[model samples]
Target: MKKLIKYGNENSQYGELYLHDTNCIGTVCLFHGGFWTMPHDLHQFDNVAHELLNLGFCVWNIEYRRIGETNHKWRDVFDDATKAINELNNIKNIYNHVNINNVFVVGHSAGGHLAIWLNSQDLKIDVKKFIGLSPILDLEIAYYKNAGDGSVEKLLHGNPNEFPERYLFGSPIKLKRKNSSELIIHGNMDDYVPIKWSKLYHEKIRKFTDISHLIELEACGHMDFIDSKSNVFDVLKSNIR
Candidate 1:
């Protein structure tokens, strides 16, 4: 069964929870990507959430305030992501069968950035794994590359020189290496976020931890990671365990 659970009072501060029947292997938290804009939402991951539920993992597909929304802030997007993950504790209280301890966070595109960023936070519960599916690892690079057509500048309210601290806080590349196992899967053909950022991030993270891994898919694109019929989805299923 699926339930809409609120993590905060705001309209966007809620997630769709997909529960397992009896026993669950763990919890898989999903964040969808839309360049922090209002055009895309959690509905993009609905198919994948159901697929994960069929695999015996409880799923939390989160929604947070994005640009173009009324009174939206960039920092609050990060805050909402944190609160949504932390809400898993309260979820555990109601659904004891859901394993919060063995949680895996999966994100695509900008959502990948949020997932890895959430891993960097000092949260109440530890994340077992952080998976980025063609995520934006470096905001500075994304800004220069003009990824999302100036979305980075719009998100931080300035360039890297102007708001260095905001970039430091938002970019996974600028954050400390997370203790949790990290996996990044990017397609060589991805024109959206590009595979370069993922490769760069993997090299940076490898200096600190041996558990981090990056996979470059041959003919895949940015949207393949979210597609249920794509091979990237199969790769995602294999690694979540």
Candidate 2:
């Protein structure tokens, strides 16, 4: 295992990444949930990686520039995610154990939103499936619902009014994939992100694809997915295989 940090253009360095043997079943690029803020990354998913490694699977826990980590951080959350995926592919070439045809991503909350968006993205990596735990995939709803602010949203799509194209292009919800490789887990009683956010994304996704599945945790809250308050880990582990 090795902990590596990749530097960015602005003297920012992506945080510690845990890379185990590359010759496992598949490479899972994990993104931790932090709502584009700082103090969040792959460290929170240490237990998940532990469970994954115990199951004889190769895993890569990724961390990148978050809101608090850099001075110019904003919409770079998505950029970091796509960059991590690309980086995973580069090292994967030598190992030859990574399932090139079936790479997986798992994320929580904001990370969940990122994981699903990665699967839907038009990037170079070939994503087999994505496990999203309480994902914030629908940006349009978050905008009108005041869940996300101007500065936070602007970092991604820029000014929504001044650049409608930017909004339309940067939003994964506004885009479509030939097929959805997604497994979404959202709490039915989530007060933070609201269940409707996942609902709206699911509804929009079904129009274009057929492989989206959502697991609604009854009587659960937003943070419960990664918290001990709920048995979300069991659910997440069961789906990992």
Best by lDDT: 1
Which sections of candidate 2 miss by over 4 Å?
Answer: 5-22, 68-75, 94-101, 148-151, 157-159, 178-180, 227-230
Residue-wise C-alpha lDDT for candidate 1, range 132-199, written one tens digit per residue: 99999999999999999898988887899998999999988888876888889999999898798888
lDDT of 2 by residue, 132-151 (tens): 88887766556666664443
Alpha-carbon TM-score of each model against the true structure = 0.97, 0.84
lDDT of 1 at 27: 92
Candidate 1 — worst ten consecutive residues by lDDT sum?
67-76
lDDT values of the candidates? 0.89, 0.69
Which runs of model 1 end up more than 4 angstroms from their true locations? none
